[model samples]
Target: MVKSPVPVFLFITAEAVALLANSAFLVVFPWLVLSHTGDAGKTSLMTALVTIPTAVATLLGGRVIDRIGRKPSSVLAGLGCAVAAAGFGVVSGLGALNIGTLIALGMLAQAFLPPSTTARDALMDAIASVGGISLERLAGIRQVVFSLTYAIGPALAGLLLTAISPIAAFWIIAGAWTFAALLTTGLPSGTSRKVSEAAITPSGSVWKLLRSRRAVWMAVVIGFGASVITQPITSVLLPAHFRDLHQPQLYGVSVSAFGVGAILGALLYAAVGAKAGVKLYVGGVLVTTAGIVAFALLPSFWILALGLALGGLGSGLLAPMLLVAVTRNTADNERGQALGVYNAASLGASPIGLGLLSLLLQRHPDLHAGAFAVLGVWALAAVYALTRPSVIVSTPGQQQAADTAAV
Candidate 1:
């Protein structure tokens, strides 16, 4: 049941575009805001306005994705991005860019994105079923694609910002997503599986899953634990530390190294499937913990890059394994909701983890290195929970069976 190349291409291209749209915001919006407002706080506020809405709206978006079907949701999301990009571009071109307008449009564009992501994943799951693709493999591929896009997107944004006006970056972003919409428009929309049935009723059953008491706990643990590392890698800890070491501009290079490592790790994990997944999960956590500790201790730019790369590898392994577990456990009808929940949990944990770490750093400068020590402990705890008897651990045979079924 090999999947047709066309569907695979469409799926991957769609994901790339969707990701580029999201990633480009981090680039385009700040530049747009800066160009207009000329204030860093205004730029930060614009970012918050966009991201907060998306995070809060994920569950609702999931329901929408389920109702409308994945393809349509994807198109709508892509179009939303395209339109937002175009609007920002036009406003910038007109010299009428305003903080109020950026905040409003940013939030609106992001509102459509999370549902689109859940739908895209739901669609991918359905396609995998037809193509006989392994969920593990698909998950791994998705991680690789995400990392690659993250690596490339910022550079492209930088180039657009430099070559054109900062506002022009929005146009480039819009153009990139327009291409993504074109690729995604071709996705097969056959009603193969419905994912809404997995939604937990408001009768407190949602808490059962949220409490990390079921098969879904695997996702919760990874989501939360991954947040601890992701924040440090993306912001204050890693980037600032690099700059302190005189390689401030190499921020992208260091992050790209990690992304590249993540791609490699995902590829390796996919090749091995579930047989290696548990071991990889445990090992990756250990590697990441070690990497964090190393980065804190060494503080050299090269050493920090190496440690971050290792940490990224660990993160890459943890995420897809968690995704496979969540997808496999949920019924098809509820799959979209289940994934949406997992994604929400994972994303929601970031602010909490980073906030706590920030507070700790502010209070106890001596605990600079020790902050990451807590993350290491969190990673270890996550791995331990993953090995618990209730986790419905996958075997190689089960992996192959699911893989075969996917096609």
Candidate 2:
């Protein structure tokens, strides 16, 4: 152990804020756009607003994280988000908020957000290596933080919708992240050493990993499929569903159950996922699909919430395992770049999903039908994934040996 819990705690808090910002995308941000413009097109466009730039930025930003150092990247990320949030507040107050401004600011925030968060991921991995924390424990803690934020962030954003103006909530987002930046007020008090060129670049390290490591490749593929399934639902369908019902709060609250279920799932993973095999992984994906089916087939409030929670449980099981797979497959010096690549491909699918969903929402009167169609797409993608050989996960010593194996 590195002799301090402060860095780990600080890192977790910063990550929580980032996840909260994402949950905001799935909640208040959509409401802000729709409430202002009353346009589903604009609201659906919000998904692209967040994802496209994030996908592109993360792809490029992964190498940037290695080049610039982790702490600086993180600080920059927090500041970017702060500006975006504060900008929203300022524009709304000035009566100047418009789609153009929203798009520009959203791009700026997302462009910075993922790389910085990835940097933090690298930073924490380093801390764990040096801090006496096992990678499994570290991954578990991070997954828990993610799950908790997903659980609470939407609920909080929704509550804000009910209790506060979107503008005020914007300021609160700004203030929270500003505090995040101050923390340089820092993780492990800063471990942003520059990675050597060889470490940073290996003809796109993540792609190489995908080619060589079945586990990493499978994680990215499953992650991409999951991303494709989720974006439209979280960013478009559910929000639209609840707002139309004039029960917008349910959107956030129901999503919260997904997060809650994630916590349970993550805990279970911590308990046993490390040793679990392909069958368990397949089960998780199926469970996740079942949750989406609930949306396609059921519209009752409590049922939606329960189904989402069930989905969360499934997701929770897979998430930490994904992290472990990626980390186990990469060395410390190359972790950020590799993760960036993993994230880029995985998250890149999100914009595609959103774009297609946007078109569907525009053409279709029934959102549930749109959801059913999404489920069909997911089924095909899952088939593609399930057909691939299950990843041959191994113990750390064996994994490290495999990591350095020739492609």
Candidate 3:
């Protein structure tokens, strides 16, 4: 039997909407904290407080996805996100939003986000299998969509925050997730065909196979590093920078610039990624690291934008590069587990970094000093990626990434 294209497209659309909503919500939430309290330390602390649940969820949510089917998991995740977001919006609308309530509601809303993301990835894999679609091609397309969300999502949130109240802006997040849940219900539903074997639970042989693949192992670290550094940029520092300026819209524009740069980087990966060898990935990381560093050094408007754009470009390349590296190295049976570890490393690392940066920035009175420190850390991470080994020799297309980079 032939599968219809509708489900695949519908799945993509649902993910796009859901992601856009989540991105907008994240931007709005931090700003809300900063604006209301007029304190950068509290904002950083609150952001870290909210991030804790998401990191924890990413670590442990695989079993839930396994038990309940990715499709149902996605649907439930959307609903949970919507309900949590709505609760926050309701409280804010009532003029009762406070730091304690914000953290509680933010944590509630954030906890669902990782599961929602994981379910979507698993769902897309299942969809590709059923539809005879290319997972690589689909993943590339989704990466573009993801980048677009950051672009429009923050800008839109900024607009709403400017024109309407944050309460109204936040309500839109709830509505978008609700819409995403409804859209997910239309897609095909089934449990993951692959088993759930997390690193901790993996047998000795599986663990050995994973570690033996040094390139992919290091690739996960690179991704984890990328995420860890980027979080402070998005969550703590940038917001503080804008809070000082007293301009919410520029904050959105700055983040949207990162998103736009990410779009280009993702597109670059799509164009030349199949053959993107170790050298090209390292080059991109170094170049993007400079951009982030520039962002920290120069706080002026246009220069700041340029720095973030460069940082954004690096994000685009690093994320997909990690995905391709993992998919190329692992077998079908091992892919699920490897991906779980990758997600944990990539997404889970952020909370720790965010929390640490929050502490550093909170203690330091000057945001610029703290910001430079964060960028310096990211620069070190980029240097670390340069030192790592390439993918396994047996893996296909290792030369292609290199060849393309050379071109």
Candidate 4:
């Protein structure tokens, strides 16, 4: 119904490659720290160093993206990642790698990620507008692409580490980011010129814009809850559960099933989510809570896998739906900032969730199920509180009109 969609596809391809590289680095970096230093504390410290800077950068990077334009910002961010990755590879190859170097490289690599993500989202919005596609549909496709990349990234990192070395893995990550940078160069320079212009004017205060949009703030709150519930489950509880069961294989299977279900969920959303309403979003939250409860309580391995898959499917739907809500509620000039804040809220929740879960586990060492049950209930309450009818009410016609006006 619109013009060529080649640029949109290319943008997604580039973003997918970048995400894969980052995911692989996430796998390899901690492994390198553990293998080299043999200290869990050092690994945790290095992770914290990276994470804190990344969160701060994400909170601030929207202004940079809005000022410089999406294409150039994305290209520069990709190049920055490539440089950091290559630097780490060289350091490792020379046998001079240390915790300090790792921390520096991690900070450098991670600081660019938020800007890259912001640029990618802005570019996708532009492309979707040109292609006459709804933002919800485009978001679904993006989620599927991301899920596929995430599914492959860790496996690829494991293979490279087994066959080659960490240095080689770092080099591969660098190459992937380099490829992403090159792809960004092909995008039109003026894809979102109007938004950029608005961003450059004196009226583009992110705080003011955020204050005006109640829906955007609500979306951020919802995203934070989703992150708090889901992140610790995968990073902490699931592994511990599998270890207690004495079947490490179940962990891999459960994770794989989750990824597959996430892909399927995204595809289903792409097919029929455009016409879906607030009930769909509420259903996703409920399903995710139910799956978490099942995963915590169910003793059978097959049932556990099903629970993980159901949770993943529901989790997959929440992200795109929230993105749609935020984009629909905000102005084009403020979209980048809104996304940045939303992302910050989500990323910032992980550590808070992890810390709280850790404290609970310390107090009751054998109460993993109870901890998860509490998280599930917390998730249910958070979603219900944030996604009320007053907060997210919107008809398809209103959304379509907003999209058309944005273009």
Candidate 5:
């Protein structure tokens, strides 16, 4: 067994740093666009530009992970993001930054995100298998780490934006990505020897493989649903709402609250090691939708925070459970591709939702709450439709046994 702690530690550390950088960039980028253009529509368009390329990259990310090995792929992705961020910062510092420039840089930076994430997931799986760690536990730990970064990153960005220039903030992000890239060098290389040759070979089109497995399709659908509801709210709506309220500080608080709740939810799942059943997953989605609705409709600041927390917790719970489901349901060699499709679906939904929300708000800027209400209901309906007994079906006995033991 590969018993060294070096790979796991380095992987987690690098991921945490990268996530922090990305989260901060997310906060800073939109704020910059909105502040500069004074237009939410432009900000939303910028977000879409970033997301679309990331989705495309994610669709091909699995094959890259499988072919090049996780370590090298992760390193290269991290380096790519760093370079893009640094370039953006330099351009901004030179006073050449515009919406088009921002969009181009955003696309460049985000294009690397999906592949880095894909490689990290694949690396985690390899670590779990070789180190005899349970995938569920590892996933739980990952969620918690992510939550912590999410908690810290936005708050830090808000502070930085308040005290520093946008160019400086971008430079900080560039540095963080550089740090993360450096950390990746310590990770072990090569594919898992335990993976079967049959599992590695392409059996036909990836779409066909996905269609053959109910769980895979279910994961993709649910991921897409979750993304549609959550991404637009955080990315476009909440920012616009807070800006209108003239309390941009509250944006950071709301984001931190969500992250805190996510941490709690992930920790709970980690402690309990619950089965990733359809019922549990759907329940989380329902709870998330309700929380988002509350966030949209509630008048009080405290209430909005509560809603954000609840929604975030629900999202947190759903993520790991879905990951566990997909991981368990897939062949070891096909795992990267399956997860790639899942990631791609989830990321792809973000641009569509953001675009729709942008158009809606552009047309009816006062209908923010109403729009969120509609999205919440839509998400609920999608989850209900997707999680029907006919859709999810039961897990195989052997897989169920393995899941139980892992938990």
Candidate 6:
């Protein structure tokens, strides 16, 4: 009912909050469950349960965004996430929580998050169309925000965990999600000037799109492989290795180094991406792969820091590039769905990859560095996938199809 700024900053704030709520609690919640249950399996399940529903909900969320508009779907998702977090807080205080209860609540919380995120992606795309900004520029802006969130959110979560109770962390996350809901309420109506009206000729349906989008599938594979490399460094290698060296504090420093590098990389992308074009994506992947290799081989803390930063920067470039690329093949009408599939694959693969990495660490501790090499291979595969004829933005038929689909 109320008017808002044309190029409003609310979406930015909403996006940052969404990232904070989704990621900050990731470090907080597992520990909360472990403190209560003292069961490793329970803790693991608590951690894994959220991803399943979130991934499933993401696909549906895309269609919902297309049908209902981005703002409304996002607001609904934000509200759901806030309410779930609030429920966890209430249950924790009342001593009514158990593993089953926590998992159920966590599932509900995550299911809402992907919908909110998909809507945000759609809204950003729509805004870029209205502003006459290129997709790369929009992606650069998104990269900056994501980088900042990854940099700040974990530190804030850790500080909250140490200074107060983990319950306080949940409250903080709830407040963030609630703020996203409020921000979404203020966004103006659609400014999409040229969404094509052609019916999505169900070319194989949603399942077909999921199957045929080689870039999307490659994105998932490469993302999962990268996560396998990174998660172990965060969870196992850093802490254990640093503890052995009697420099546990370096563990935190190393993690911070990765975050700072990501922020810097995203900033760099924001500055040069529109002009850099495909070079940005190509260079980023190579830098990232090299960084991962260096991280594994270099035992010194300083070198490790540099490697992590380089890799983070590389990771930062892909998001925006991939977003733009995904949208190129998608019709304006189906932008939400296409982006959802791309975003979902990117989000969905990490847990599976990380889980397998954890298993490898347990079974073949010597293969730890091998994990990084695997990521490099995957990145090369992703590069190859991006080069396929169907993925090239220069293809007229695909471009025409994309233009028609968005309406």
Strongest candidate by lDDT: 4
The alpha-carbon deviation from the true structure for residue 312 of candidate 3, after best TM-score superposition, in angstroms, is 2.4
lDDT of 2 at 44: 82
> What stretches of model 6 exceed 4 Å from their correct place?
1-8, 38-41, 92-95, 162-164, 191-204, 210-228, 367-369, 372-376, 382-407
For every model shown, the clashing-pair count is 11, 4, 5, 0, 0, 10
TM-score of each: 0.86, 0.78, 0.73, 0.89, 0.78, 0.84
3 or 4, which is superior by TM-score? 4
Off-target runs (Cα >4 Å) in candidate 5 are: 27-51, 89-104, 161-171, 190-204, 235-255, 274-283, 289-304, 358-407
TM-score-wise, the better of 1 and 3 is: 1
How do the residues 11-102 of candidate 2 rate in per-residue lDDT, one tens digit apiece?
A: 67777777787676557667777888899997887755665677778877777887778888878877888888899988877998988877
Stretches of candidate 3 exceeding 4 Å from the true structure: 1-4, 27-48, 88-104, 129-133, 161-171, 189-216, 234-257, 275-283, 289-307, 328-337, 354-376, 387-389, 392-407
Query: RMSD for each model, in Å, please?
Result: 4.5, 4.3, 6.0, 3.6, 5.1, 4.3
Q: Any idea what lDDT model 3 has?
A: 0.74
Q: Judge candidate 3 at residue 40 and give its lDDT.
A: 96
Q: Using alpha carbons, what is the TM-score of model 1?
A: 0.86
Cα RMSD (Å) between model 4 and the true structure? 3.6
Determine the C-alpha RMSD for candidate 6 after optimal superposition of all C-alphas. Answer: 4.3
User: Which residue pairs of candidate 4 clash?
Assistant: none
Tell me the tens digit of each residue's lDDT in model 5 across 157-251. Answer: 99999998777788889899889988987765543323444556473467776766666677777777777767777766677778878999998
Stronger candidate by lDDT (2 vs 4): 4
Per-residue alpha-carbon lDDT of candidate 1 for residues 1-407, written as tens digits (9 for 90 to 100) = 44565677678877987797678777877777777777888777677767888776677766666565667777787788789778877876687767777887788777777777777776766666655667678778888998888888878777777788766667777887788878877766562343443443333354454443355655666666777557655776666665666777888777776787788888877777556745676676677676666666656678878987887787777677777777776655455667778777777777776677777777776545544555565657555664652353464355435444644
Cα lDDT, all candidates: 0.69, 0.74, 0.74, 0.77, 0.75, 0.70
Which of the two, 2 or 3, has more TM-score?
2
